[model samples]
Target: MDARTQWDAGRSEEWADVTPDAARRLLTAAVQAFAERGYHATTTRDIAGRAGMSPAALYIHYRTKEELLYRISGIGHRLALGIVSRARDGGGDPAGRLSAAVQDFVRWHAEHHTTARVVQYELGALGEEHHAEIVALRRETDAAVRSIVEDGVAAGEFDVPDVRGTTRAVLSLCIDVARWFREDGKHTPGEVGELYADLALRMVGYAHK
Candidate 1:
């Protein structure tokens, strides 16, 4: 595994700062359990056991299992936005920036498949308020991608037919990496990233130009 392809185990001190150590353990454990057994099928006992705590110990940190889902989902969304924002705004032309954005976004989804699966596909499992909040975060990603496409068009670097549709397609392709990517698969995250970046460029008529 290339260091760049490391699955972000969500071990950041930032998340740890807001969440107590035990609570954070539960969250990490929940991500794996939920990813393995799914949100509906996974029990609090499963989560607690995975965290090496009694079932009742879970309540000390979270009111319910859905609460755990919300926190993980929130963290996942922020991580997605943070990565794309950097790729979008950090040094590059429109095409260069969009390529970097697609590559990195796809890599993260593929590398962090378990967490990304829950985040991208399991939003419906959250409470109404939590779902809404996650949707807002998703919109930020959509906007960032769209803006890059717009910039490409404005600069005559891309020949897109529908900026909005194209942006959605680009992100959909990247997000779907979580669904099928496997560690035993042929491509590394870096390889997938490179391949997807080229595909993104081609999608906008980079080669056609």
Candidate 2:
């Protein structure tokens, strides 16, 4: 399949760092299966089959289904956190940085909606320890956005009354794109990102012009 098809089908190169071709294949297959059937419903055998491997091969790569979920969650969440953190640290004024953060964050979710769906929605299926780790990463992501809002407020560039709530609301708006975005949708990922960025700026009471 073409790269686009692979990505839309959840076989994205987002996990290209995963070692060994077989392991990457399994990771890709696991993402596809989990995104489609959910972590609780998807089986190791199913993932193995999708990767064109025997079930035993799955064991060699990943100890259990939850391990696959943990791997996926860790990678995806870190990627998301990096996106927001870069915008937070990037050289820009508060409004500019906030807009960049929301725009890029939303674009990633829309473009990688399939992977994002599994990453954002399948956390509950992770083991307790794994869940905690993911939660910590999520908190960092929240902090990244909150820091931008705080900066905006401090700079008098935004009129947010509740920085924490507004930060979450912004994240929620961007993250939800994964649940609903489609390649064939009226808006391309970039368009959705631009639109959401504008809305986010408005939410902060910034007169982005």
Best prediction by lDDT: 2
lDDT of 1 by residue, 64-99 (tens): 999999999998899899889998798778988998
| Local distance difference test values of all predictions, in order | 0.86, 0.90
Per-residue error at 196 for model 1, in Å?
0.4
What are the clash counts of all predictions, listed in order? 0, 0
lDDT by residue (tens digit), candidate 2, 144-207: 9999999999998899988899999999999999999887778877788889989999999995
Ten-residue stretch with the least lDDT total in model 1: 5-14
lDDT of 2: 0.90
lDDT of model number 1: 0.86
